[model samples]
Target chain A: MHNKTVAELSKGLAAGSFSSVELTQHFLTRIAQQDPALNSFITVCNDEALADAKAADAKIASGSASPWTGIPFAHKDIFCTQGVKTSCGSKMLDNFIPPYDSTVTRNFKQQGAVCLGKTNMDEFAMGSSNESSYYGRVVNPWGENLVPGGSSGGSAAAVAARLTPAATATDTGGSIRQPAALCGVTGLKPTYGRVSRYGMIAFASSLDQGGPIARTAEDAAMMLNVMASYDDKDSTCIERDVPDYTSTLNNSIEGLNIGLPKEFFSDHLNANMQQQVENAVKELEKLGANIKEITLPHTELSVPAYYVIAPAECSANLSRFDGVRYGHRCADPKDLEDLYCRSRTEGFGDEVKRRIMVGAYALSAGYYDAYYRKAQQVRRLIKNDFTAAFNDVDLIVGPTSPTPAFGFNSKGDDPVKMYLEDIFTISTNLAGLPGMSIPGGMIDNLPVGLQLIGNYFDEARLLNVSHQFQQATDWHTKTPKGFE
Target chain B: MSIKREDAENIARLAKLQISDEQLEKITGDLSNILSLVDQLKAANTQDIEPMAHPMDAVQRLRPDHITETDNREAFQKIAPATEEGLYLVPKVIE
Candidate 1:
C-alpha cells in the first residue's frame, strides 16, 4: 500500500480496497518508525491526520470522493498550515503556527487529501542542501551519508521513501528539482505565477514557485491539478485557466523537437552524469523526439545573476518578520533597534542571515547599479536566450545538477560551490518558464535527474514529455535499498 | 567587488541582524566569496536592455478597492510573540 503511486492509490480508494483511515494509518505508522532515522518531517499531525482520514472515509461512503480524496501527502514546511507549525525549516518560525491555511494547503484540504505532516527544508528555502535546516539535515534514503539535495529535500525524500505518495514542494532556484533529482523522484516547478504563492514563504519572489514531488510523472500531474490555481489573494498569481494536467500525460511526442543546451554538456558536468543524461536523451530519441543542439549563451551568467536577484528580493520580503508582529522575538529589548536585530539574529540560521546580509549589500545605495541592477539586466538576457532556443525546439533538456548527491558536508566551507549546485536549474526560474526533473538514471548508485524545460505556460507539454520518458524507462520506479 | 569585514557589518546593521564578532568574521568571508561569484555578471554587456523585474513583464493587476476581506486581527494576533488587547506589542518607539 505504501509503495503504490498516487494513481494506484486513487484506484484502490475508489474500489473500497481500504478505508481512508486505514491508508492514513499505514503511512503514519511508517513515518513514526522510519522518520526518526530520516528526520524528514518537522511536525507530524497525528490526531489531525486521523480525523481528516475518517472524514474522507465518510465522504467516500457518500460517493462524493475526488481522485485525491483520502490520499496521504506531505506539505513542505514552507506552506502555512492552520494550527500546525509552518516552520519554513527555520527557528524563527519554529513555534509560529498560522491561524489560517495557505492557499496550497487549502486546495489540498478541499480535495480531501490527508495531511501526514509538514516536511523539513533549508531555512527559508535558501540552501542547496538540507543541512541549513534548523531541525538538522535530512539523510538521503539511498545512502545515509549522502545529502537529500534541498531546500525541498524532505519532500523528495519522503516521496522516495514511500512515506507519502506525493508531497508539495517549492523551487526558488533549484529547491524542488535538485532534491528530487538526488532522491530519485519526479518534481515540477510550474511557470512563475502558474500557482498561487499567497501563503508559501517567500525566498525570492521572482524565482519562487510551488509544485509537486512524486514517484512518477503521472502522480505529479495528479497533484498539480490540485496545486495550480489562480488566487486573487496572491497578486502575482497568473489569471489563467487551470487545466486537468493529467489529461495530457499520454500525448504523443513523435516529431517533437527537443533542445540540448551546449553549455550544459561542457567539461563542468561530471563524466558519469554526462553519460546518464546522454542515455536519457537516447531514450527520448527512441520515443520519437528529435534532439537539437542549442545555445543559451548566458547560461554561465545564471549563478551570479541569481545570487544577486534572489538575495535582493529576500532582504525585502523577510523585512516583514521583525520582532514585533509574529515569529520569534528577543527575550528583552532595551530599544526598538535592539529588539529587531537580536530577534532576527537569534531566530534565523546562518544560511538565512548570510543571504539577508548579501541581499542588503547588493541593494545598498552605492552597490545597486553594479550589483542589483546589473544582475537584473543579465537576467533579461538569460530570459531572451531561452526565448530564442524555444523558437527552434519544443522543449529544452539537460542534467538537473552537474552531479548526483554529494556527502553531507562535502562543500561546507565554500558558499560559491554550494550555489553552483543549482547551475542547471536556475535559468528556468530566471525566465519564469515551467521546468521539471524526472529520474533519468543512476550514477555511482545515486540518481541523476533529466531536467525538462518548456516555454512559458507549457507545463502540459512538459508533463507529457516526462510521462512518455517514464513509460519507456523504470528509473522513476526504483526505490532505495532499505526503503524497499 | 569583494565584501570587506566592515562592509558585512554595515550590511548586517542595515538588514537588522545582530552579528557577534565571531559570526562577523565568517560572514565577511562567505559574503566576499559569494560576491566574487556574482561579479561574473559584470562580464555580460547590457548597455541598452532594461532591468527585468519579472519574467513576463507583468503589470500589477488592480482590483476593486472595496473591502475584500473580513477582519481577522484577533485570530492573526493570537500567534504573535507579544500582544495586548487586540494589538501587537512592540518595544516603544517613543518615550
Candidate 2:
C-alpha cells in the first residue's frame, strides 16, 4: 500500500480494497518510523490525518468521491494550513498556525485528500540544499550522506521514500525541480499564473509557482488536476480554463519537436549527467520526438540575473515579519526600531538574511538602476530567448541541475557556488514558462533529472511528453535501496 | 562591485535586520561575492530591452470596492506576539 502511487491508491480506495483509515494509518506509521533519519516532515498530523481519512471513507461510501478523495499526501510547509503549523522551515514561522487556509490547502481539502503532514524546506524557500531548514537538513533517501536538493527537499524526499504518494511543492529558481531530480521523483512547476499563489509564502513573487511532486508523471498529473485553478484571491492567477491534465497523458509524441539548447550541454553540465539526459532524450526520440539543437544565448546570465531579481523581491516580501505580527518576536526591545531589527535577526536563518541584505542593497536608492533594474532587463532578455526558442521547438530539454545532489555543506561556504546549482532550472522561472523534472537515470547511485521546459501554459503537453517517456522507461519506478 | 563593511551595515539597517560585529565581516564577504556574481549582468546588452516585473506581464486585478471578508480580528490577533483589546501592541514609536 505504501509503495503504491496516488493513482493506484485512488483506484484501491474506489474499489474498497482498503479503507482510507488503513491507508492513512499505514503512511502515518511509516512517517513516524522513517522520518527521523530523513527529517522530511516538520509536522505529522496523525490525528488530523485519521479524521480526514475517516471523512474520506464516508465520502467514498456515499459514492461522491473524487479521484483524489482518499489520497494521502504531504504539503510543503510553505503553504498555510489552517490550525496547523505552517513554518515555511523558518523559526520565524515556527509558531505560526495560520488562522485560515492557503488557496492550495483549501483546494486539497475540497478534493477530500488526506494530508499526512507538512514537509520541511529551506527557510523561506531560499537555499539550494535543505540544510538551511531550521528543523535541520533533510537527508536524501537515495544516500543519507548526500543532500536532497532543495528548498523542496523534504517534499521530494518524502515522495521518494513513499512516506506519501505525492506532495505539493513550489519552485522559485529550481526549488521543486532540483530536489525532485535529486530525490528521483517527478516534479512540475506549472507556468506562472497557472497555479494560485495566494497562500503560498512568497519567495520571489514572479518566479514562484506551485505544482506537484510524485513518484510518476501520471501521479503528478492527478495532483495537478486539483492544484491548478483560477482564483480571484490570487490576482496573478490567470482566468484560463484548467484542463484535465491526465486526459493527454497517453497522447502520442510522434513528430514532437524537442529543443536541446547548445548552451546547456556545454561545460556547465557534468559529462556523465549529460550522457544520462541524452539517453532520456533518445528514449523520447524513440517515442517519435524530433530533436533539434537550439540556442538560448542569455543562458549564462540567468543565474546572475536571478540572484538579483529573486533576492530583491524576497527582501520586500519578507518585510511582513516585523516582530509585531504572528511570527517570532525578540525580547526586551527598547524601541520600535530595535524591536524590528532584533525580531528579524533572531528569526531568519543565515541564507535568509544574506538574501535580505542583498535585496536591500540592490534596491537601495543609489544602486536600484544598476542592480535591480538591470536584472529585470536581463530577465526580459532571458524571457525573449525562450520566446524565440519555443517558435522552433515544442519543448526545451536539458539536465535539471548541472550535476546530481552533493554532500551537505559542499557549497555552503560560498554563496556563488551554491547559486550555480540552479543554473539549468532558473531560466524557466525568469521566463514564466512551465517546466518539469522527471528522473532520467542514476549517476553514482544518485538520480539525475531530465528537465522539460514548455511554452507558457503548455503544461498538458509537458505532462503528456513526460508520461509518454515514463511509460517507455523505468527510471521513475526505481526506489532508493533501504526504502524499497 | 565588492560590498564593504559599511555597505553591509547600511543594507542590514535598511532591511531592519541586526547583524552583530562578529557576524558583519563574513556577511560583508558573502555579500561581496554575490554582488560580483550579479555583476555579470552588466555585460548583457539590455539597453533596449524592456524590464519585466511579472512573467506574463500581468496587471494587478481590481475587484468591486466592497467588503468580501467577514471580520476575523479576534481569530487573527490570537497569534500576535503582543495584542490588547483587538489592537496589536508595539514598542513606542513617538513620545
- DockQ winner among the candidates? 2
Model 2 residue B90 CA deviation in Å: 1.4
Local error of candidate 2 at residue A290 (angstroms): 0.7
Taking the candidates one at a time, how many backbone clashes does each contain?
A: 0, 0
> How many pairs of residues in model 1 come into backbone collision?
0
Tens-digit lDDT string for candidate 2 (A287-403): 999999999999999999999999999999999999897999999899998999999999999999999999999998988999999999999999999999989999999999988
User: What does candidate 1's lDDT look like per residue over A397-442, in tens digits?
Assistant: 9999988999988996888889999899999999999999999999
Indicate the worst ten consecutive residues by lDDT in candidate 1 chain A: A321-330
Which residue pairs show collisions in model 1?
Answer: none
What lDDT score is found at residue A268 in candidate 2? 88
TM-score against truth, every candidate: 0.99, 0.99
Best by lDDT: 2
Instruction: List candidate 1 stretches off by more than 4 Å.
Output: none
